[model samples]
Target: MATITVFGATGYAGGHITDEALRRGHEVIAVNRSGSAAAREGVTPVAGSIGDDALVRDLAARSDVLVVAVHGSADGQPYLAALVPNLLKAAAEGGARIGVVGGAGSLKVREGGPRLIDTAGFPEAARTESASHAKVLDALRAADTGADWFYVSPAAEFGAWVPGERTGTYRLGDNVLVTDEHGKSFISGADYAIAFVDEIDEPAHHRARFTVAY
Candidate 1:
């Protein structure tokens, strides 16, 4: 089993990823700002901010895969820009595979055109958070580190999605969105976790970004 480290262990997406990692029999280390109590048999909780370079580096050095599921605040906090690069650096030094829980706003809507966030009918309240995500993507793309990293963007309607039965079935897509036969783009959190852990086990798409939807 792979040694995995989840950066934002208390968040919704991160928590689900942690559970899925544990269920897959992988050893998981959950890193949170304060601390996390959602303990499992094989899950270890590490308390520290992403800004603490020493602590993050120590955790990264011990893991094989690092899952970044951190979300910046809507009030224009510079945490995303600051933390991700540092984590990426540590992961590179540790020779670890990086998996990012990316935002849907970074996904493209057209070929070499604007993203989904810029398109019409997008909610105004989400623009700031989306922009922050875009910035994080830019930083990751421009990074020169030599680590295998995959950024996974969930469906447009992803938030507080309850888990369905563990069918282990989901569709993957590239930069563009993925939709079902019913013209819907959504995946349950459980299915998302399945995809995430599957990628962790067998990395088919290396150094690229992908999405998941039912």
Candidate 2:
């Protein structure tokens, strides 16, 4: 199994992803602020920040894949600006692929239509964060050819607030949002991890962004 290093391992999405990786017999390096991720087999908890270039490079070098499940900010400061560059360099140095947990804001409301973030009635509170994530996607696209990466944007109704049960099924899409027959887009955290880990197991959509939903 691939050795995966996951940042933000204590967080919702990362936690589930880490667990799933362990479930599949993949070794995990769980990085978090406190390094207090639940004690579990196959997990090596690391207390570190994504801002630490040395630590990131070290971990990236040691693993087959680096998973970024963090946000745009760290310690109240903008982090993505440096994160992408650091990851690119580390991935190149370590020959490891990068997997990012991206935001849905960059996904189009429909084919050839405006992005969801630009649509009317989008949550003002999430505007800044969403826009930042969109930038992350752009940064990856513009990264050097040697940098191998893939981004996964969850459905609009994703997050800890709705901890829906895993149904062992999900819909996948390209840069467009995936919605159900009633126009609702959603995916439980567990199912999202399944999709993420499945990609880690079998490479697909290299250097591209994909979305997951019900």
Top-TM-score structure, candidate number: 2
Worst 10 residues of 2 by lDDT: 73-82
User: What C-alpha lDDT do the candidate models reach, one value each?
Assistant: 0.82, 0.90
Clashing pairs in 1: none
List candidate 2 segments past 4 Å from native. 74-77
| Candidate 2 C-alpha lDDT tens digits along 1-214 | 8999999998889988998899899999999989998778899999999879999889988999999999975454456855798889989898999999999999999999999999999998888788888888898998776878999999999999987998889989999999999999999999999999999999888999999999
18-81 per-residue lDDT for model 1 (tens digits): 8898887999888897776477699888888766889878888899998888885446654586
RMSD (CA, Å), each prediction = 1.8, 1.2
